[model samples]
Target: MGVCGMLRVVQTGIGGLDVYDVQTCPVPKPAIGEILIRTEFAGINYLDVLMRRGEYTSTPKLPFTPGCGIVGTVVELGSSVNGQSGFAVGDRVVVLTQSGGYSQYVTADARAATHVPEGVPSDKAVCCVSSYVAAHQLLHRAARVHGGWRVLVHSAAGGVGTALTQLARIAGCAVYGTASAGKHDTVRGLGAVPIDYRSSDFVVEMSRNEPDGIDAVFDPIGGEHWLRSRRVVRRGGIVVGYGMRTIRTAARMLVASRGRRFSYYSMNTRNVLQNTEDLRLILNLCSENIIDPVIGPRLPLERVHDAHRLLTDGAITGKALLDCR
Candidate 1:
């Protein structure tokens, strides 16, 4: 915890988490036009899970720290970085780091970081970069959802789901959300028509309720769920596939249900390529404010294992966060 030393969670090459105690590396010296941050909080996302499992299409080299979004106070600035350019030494900010968020400190391109408003807590700001920004990008820009549109969002109680539902409602769209039965009320409270994905055929239910069909479907649960989504969306209605949660779940379930006789890799590579394009649409929603991500259970840095357990167990309602300070 000394100024000259740092504590970081390192990913072992074998796909395990290990905490390393090292002399705080010199506060990452900011390069020209960069800023150093004393991180206060970090957002743990599903991408982090994929990164850990070595399942993501692109993986960082081994032994790297994993954290994508962070909120902190600026501590140092590079000479080419203007302290007065809408920021100062003490400014509260959130950064979209490609990595390095699991540590106590970070250095990032000044342009990729944004100053937080006065009233928003650092934790909330942390949500903005990944969850909120992603939600905004997907719903408004990618989907082009608008008033009177009928939308269906998978994982409604989740971070991205919650954000999309809220923003859709704000845009005057009617939203239907899928979640476990236990989370239905939570989704309803957010102003979405809730569908219990565990017990219902969402496509059938939506068809029964709105036969004209949905205008857009926000599906992070890819794989088989993609087919189900297609059924609910009207022709020309877009289905945005951002995550492989459904595919991963299907793979695990296939192993459990068939007792080692099934493999989930039968899907074609063309499908994967198309799915990535769907994700790009979600990213475009960020600047439009349509998908605002929801903040879920938060844990201190020391409890990272607990956070991982909660996420893996499907017990959290939204994105989990690591309070790094």
Candidate 2:
């Protein structure tokens, strides 16, 4: 509040990062179709961690703040930005941003934000962008899952995984999920049949259970997992690949080998090209309620490095959050 300053978590141009304090850039003034928000919570995503490590495809120039979405109260509104954007000063809103969310204040294009319904916690609304939207898109759009279908979701206890499982069940599909052994029960509790990804060949197990194979596979892990995913789906069944956790794993291994031969650019480009529809479908699903994101551990803005380490290490389930305020 002093001098209208805002605190933000910024990348320091190093591989992994530590926080730096910058006086709030002059409080962003709203232009037409824009609104200023005092952010209450920001969603931390795997993409953020990847960006911090210089591994994500869409890395921002260094010394930038990292946060993708926010749940906040509108503090100022520009002329021509009102009911059409569905917000006004004092309105509770959730905004999606490519970056710049880990701050005390944000200026958003009104069209890109949603008003949070009464009774929804700010923390929960933060999940709508990354987790819920991803889940909704994967099941309803990419996979075209419907009643009577059988679906398989990987990392079932995690954010997108859990959302997909719940949404699939709501849509009357039989849901199966793969996770670490320790998370199987949690997956099952969410109405998914849990498969232990570590101890089992999921493709073989799924085939044995469904016999006809599953109608779709929602996978964020690529690399060798895609081979198995292809096998688990019935003929023409869709495999929606959103993240490349497997590729990241492989990349890390390649970093350790002096003569490792592979082009990160080529591989990532191919991966993105192949998954364009999948991402489009994810976006569509968010406009509807087929999937709802599961919020995970919430950390303060300054501890973003710890958040990244937790995500990379898979130490936490679901999506991690940054309470920017």
Which lDDT values do the candidates have, in the order given?
A: 0.71, 0.70
Candidate 1 lDDT over residue span 59-108, tens digit each: 57876778888889998888788846566798887777556787788887
* True-vs-predicted CA distance for residue 129, candidate 2, Å: 2.3
- Give lDDT tens digits, candidate 2, residues 108-135: 7876666676666677677765566666
RMSD of each: 7.5, 6.8
List the candidates' TM-scores in order: 0.82, 0.81
Q: Which segments of candidate 1 are over 4 A away from where they belong?
A: 14-26, 248-293
Kindly report which residue stretches of model 2 are placed more than 4 angstroms away from their true locations once superposed: 1-3, 18-26, 82-85, 248-293
